[model samples]
Target chain A: MSTPSKTLGDYVLGLADDALVSAQRMGWWISRAPQLEEDLALANIGLDQLGQARTLLSYAGQLEGDGRTEDDLAYLRDEREFRNVWLVERAQSDFGVTMARLLLFAAWQSELYAALASCPDPTLAGVAGKAVKEVAYHLDHAARWVVRLGDGTEESHQRMQAALDAEWPYLDELFRPVEGAVVDPASLHPLVLARIEPVVAEATLEVPQVAPARGGGRAGLHTEELGYLLAEMQHLHRSHPGATW
Target chain B: MRDWPLWEVFVRSRRGLSHVHVGSLHAPDAEMALRNARDVYTRRQEGVSLWVVPAAEIVASDPGERDAFFDPADDKVYRHPTFYNVPEGVEHL
Candidate 1:
């Protein structure tokens, strides 16, 4: 059994992992987006995610008292070591799919950060305060795209609905409490769901109905896709352990 | 759909100031134009407001008109307030 401190470290790492994985996914679209404006927007959102990851990972390292920096956690972790939900690691299917993912992810993250802003831990609260603003903007951006695509032309509406249907299954894992996981599900559960429901409804997307995916990320049970994601994300760091610009 | 036209962005950093040209971006319409302007131009929190006009709307004076248009103003000291005088009680003067 893990001590409370260690459990806290694990919980922080889980949040950091979520940000890190999402940032990597967004970074992949840097120059490959359909338009220049979207390219910049994705890049900006990726930077925000990376910034949040850095803060959360650093806090986790400090809590662990393992002398691991943010870079150590981000660059040294292997696939099985990461704790991000499967939603963030899935491949970017199409523009509408990407928007759907963002809409769902950002809504949850915005609420999570808002609650964390008042967490008992001062460091966590500080980090969450800064991150909440960034996530709010991210949520707005995604929501706008969802509304536009969902209500636009027939083709756009069809594509966006398809994307929503496809991505909905993955959202359950976001709110699922890992059995014996560090963070208490009962403590955070109500706040997370309350904040996410309205945004999901506003987007005209249905709440995920599937049973939560078993094997929570806190247990290091990740989807197979995480391996490839880690391979690409950790390559430079693993290749040159202490590399710096 | 094809991409939107480029729009030149002007921002007013504060009230009572002229809108200064910042940069340009492509937007599908006026609504999108304002949003893109807010994101790209005001991310740094530099502006209190923004104005986006299509790049094509701007007209320019010929470079050859520099002397004829601007040089005459350089010699017109009367156009400026240097000759103004005020009473001792005129606080602003």
Candidate 2:
């Protein structure tokens, strides 16, 4: 492949990191979701995110023209060195919160990937084309959960609303535009909102007017939770350098 | 969560193919059950379409009636496709 501009590389890197971090978080739900079926569902969704991470990471590495492999990009980086939004990094111990974060994140990804699917960059376009379908499923799954919990019993409705409120702050981070990206992130915000609003409405949930969190993940700045997550994710690689089955 | 009803899943591998019973999963409603079936049964390109029916709705015949219901047909060799003569130039019969 001819040399890709660093701008494109950085944009794809952000996308890769987004999928990678979200995969790590989603993996936490396996065997831990409310039901066994839900566990399998989350595991499948997590695997999808992991698959996207691998493909995008490899492409991002190529664009950077650096010798770093996907493994190097994942295992060797410090928390601040990563570029995923805080939406996927923070602790989501509550299942409702997990679904809420997923709904927001996947909605943005749905729009972002759809826009990127037809971009001039063939590699990015190819990746986005595949990812758009995967994210569509993710969005649907999340929306289902959000609707079920939010419109169910009073206790569940309260909890789901609270989850949405908690996740709202991180929503802004997703729309911060990155240079050299196929689509302007800012441009996809309204489309993402349109995808999310109907789901929220049907769930009988409100989109809270909470202030946006201070987000610098695109600049390699991350939340305190990311450090803990990175410790777990990077530990195995650091302990057994270059070892693989 | 315990209130979620169990749904029997059926998957059609492709168009023009009959849906085969796969397995069962618990879901709150038919829409969610279809999504759950997509995740549980069709994750590996296993099917193009899915059907989810509430487990309570299926009226399965009693196993105790196995002899009365199926044994009578066993001795009727004429009813079996196995008695058909082998035709040349044909396969997968």
Candidate 3:
């Protein structure tokens, strides 16, 4: 069977979009985190994600040989043009929900980046190598929270479990195969799950059993939340079009 | 849930150096405290190592006893090596 064709630009953009959207969501918790320390931690995590997004997006723009700069791709694109996973686009408000989402996202990212680090693409490999370290920290932060909140108080435990269950449907979306991509999402599932299952068990929490959400975010289709997210993220840049800070 | 107790953070920027006081954060346990310190204080690659001590466990000199605690050392100029002529080649004296 002949292999399908996939552009390196498109593949990098998908990873970029995931980090960019996730960073945006993570930034929302800066001042509103449960505690001051947590506020700092979450903000740092957001900055790391944003850094990865910037590098990947810039690389994507370069690979496409489009005259568009990183800012153009980030701010000028509409909701349908973004290629992030749905898992990062959901509105995450509650602390438990945020932790659950982060745990899964970071876990997947750690495995994904580790694999991509060895891929034939050097730019992709360099970006992935740098990103894997940051993602490891993110995964640790989320894991600690998951275990804490999952095993903490009666209310916290219940809420953490609910958060896990609510986010579980989105898990399968991360493992969906990408055709002709250097990184295989399906190959990452078992490794990511290995990292997650022990944490869940240690937290005295049960892994949720639920059907996977239908994912089309990789095809430039996202949840309704992405529309609102883009509106807020793009407003300033779009209003002044090409104005620098 | 209730707020975690405060932990004082110290970060050693490199090996073979002492961990210096950085700042403080709140965590339920020592493990989480160290992790929080890593996140909050070392985000900028500030340290190679970290130390977190429970604030409650620290023993501090009373500020009200400033004179009794630290004044005695002020007059001890003899404790300074300046009284002796330092040999030119002597280092870290």
lDDT of 1 by residue, A43-128 (tens): 78998999999998998898788899999999897878888888888888498888888987887887788777887788888888
- Summarize candidate 3's per-residue lDDT along A40-149 as a digit string, tens digits: 88888888899889988998788777677789889999998899999999888999999999999999999999999998878889988998999999999999899988
Order of candidate numbers by DockQ, starting with the best = 2, 3, 1
lDDT of 3 at A216: 94
Q: Taking the tens digit of each residue's C-alpha lDDT, what string does model 2 give over A11-98?
A: 8889999999999999988788999888888999889899889988988888788788999999998987798989999988899999
- All candidates' TM-scores? 0.86, 0.94, 0.93
The runs of at least 3 residues in candidate 2 whose Cα sits more than 4 Å from the true structure, single-residue gaps closed, are A1-4, B81-93
* Candidate 1: Cα lDDT at B40: 80
Best by DockQ: 2
- Per-candidate DockQ values are 0.42, 0.85, 0.71
Q: Pick the candidate with the highest TM-score.
A: 2
lDDT of 3 by residue, B20-75 (tens): 99888888889989988987899778999999999999999999999998999998
Off by over 4 Å in 3: A1-6
Order of candidates by TM-score, top first? 2, 3, 1
